[model samples]
Target: MEWIFILFLLYTLIPVWRQQRIHIARYKTIRKLESNRGSRVITLIHRQESLSFLGIPFRSFINIEDSEQILRAIRLTPDNMPIDLILHTPGGLVLASEQIAVALQKHPAKVTVFVPHYAMSGGTMICLAADEIILDENAVLGPVDPQLGRFPAASILEVIKIKELEHISDDTLIMADIARKAIQQVKTFIKQLLLPKMDEQRAEQLSEILADGRWTHDYPITGEWLKEFGLSVRFGLPKEVYLLMELYPQSPSRRPTVQYIPIPYRVENNDK
Candidate 1:
């Protein structure tokens, strides 16, 4: 009887020990995040590891909260000086992504996006809103089609079921229909925010392409794409990004590096 009791206690204690370990790990991560929140510019990099769901690891998805935290960091910056946003995400929540993009646009400082690896989906959207985008030769950008949440997907599935019951459905069912509508919604939101700074037609076209493009993965657009889009893209990283601490009397974040290749566009006569 004592052996049975001991075994049960051991089983209970094992789970408790795991939980405590997880808590400690999470605490450390939060502390690390807090420690790096005061830089003049913030880099939103891609997830090297998979994201967590209910404490279980899965493929890393964009955490809007993380992006918001970065935005909050920018807000906390003293005097709102120009902020360079380094990006390397595979994209996540479209709405959350847009929120970051909007914040970057509304902030009273120039926002630059530096893509060293790749920016996709919502990541690309954030890049589009930037006053300038800096890309290395190996960097890539992707389309901005909004993905469906559980609620939306369930609703659509229900509609399909009802349609099938009513004998009014066709064999041409595709998510593109849903994607198209989502694209329109995102495009409208983006246009409302960006139209003042861009031409109506150009903005609309960009919105459409971003929301409905075939390049889902590994689509590295060239500088010519920006030129064709009529954006004011330029070359070279800012001087401040490369100067080292020895040469410049500033923190490492302010020091300039040749790693970033800036892309600024020239506005067209009609765009103006």
Candidate 2:
């Protein structure tokens, strides 16, 4: 029984030990990236976090707290000092996202956002406010249209348009009214972010295209597509930035579905 208890304790502590080591390594890497960039580095990474002891997973998204902390970080940055934000998220609340985006937009110095992976919805809205966006060649941004409950705001409004008023339910009519306002609000916010980067005509066009719900909410707006819109999008993410990302991993409850040799694989070109 004594031996069994000792073994059980070791099993329980191993994960905790690994967690602490990874946390320390993350802090060190963040500090190094800040030093290398000469800018205040902030990261907005929303990975599904798990309770250490319970092993229960929880989804994370941008909320008021995120806005408050990011705003504080921006406030601490010196005037005319560049800001570098490493962003990776599925996006979140319009109010929170707009608050962060406006702060980035109003900064006196250059603001750069690096997306190693995807930044969707409100994340894309925040990206638009940056002076420049650096993405991994395969990284993606998404549409900024508002979502009402489980449905897209634009889709909700469409039901009212295509159906007779007598046919439309009171609940749906109420949703349609709110949807119209939601679409308009998000469209206006996106336009404000783009105005500094392009002429009014192009900015208005791009904003409408993004917020008009022309595509599904999860559509991946590739980096190549962004350049066509004249947004300052640079490819080739920094190696250091990638290292920083490795620190914020997914919940460790399940075995990873994708795995391969971690090093570069190359075939020698032999003249035969």
Scored by TM-score, the top model is 2
Per-residue lDDT of 1-272 in model 2, one digit per residue for the tens?
99999988987888788878888987788788778878888989998755465667789889999999999999999977899999999999999999999999999989999999999998999999999999998899999999998999989988988999999999999999899999988888888888888999998999999999999999999988999999999998768789878887777755657788899889999999
Q: Where is the poorest 10-residue window by lDDT in model 1? A: 243-252
Worst 10 residues of 2 by lDDT: 48-57
For candidate 1, give the lDDT: 0.62
Off by over 4 Å in 2: 1-12, 253-256
> Per-residue CA lDDT of candidate 1, range 1-272, in tens?
99999987886677557656645654454344335533356656544321222233334556778677977976786555666776667788876887888877777767777766578877877877787788765566776655575333324444565665446444324653574577678778767655766799888877666555445434666655866787655555433323211121111233675555556678778754
Q: How high is the lDDT of residue 188 in model 1?
A: 85
**Candidate with the greatest lDDT versus the true structure:** 2
Clashes of 2: 0
| Model 1 residue 33 distance off true place after TM-score fit, in angstroms | 18
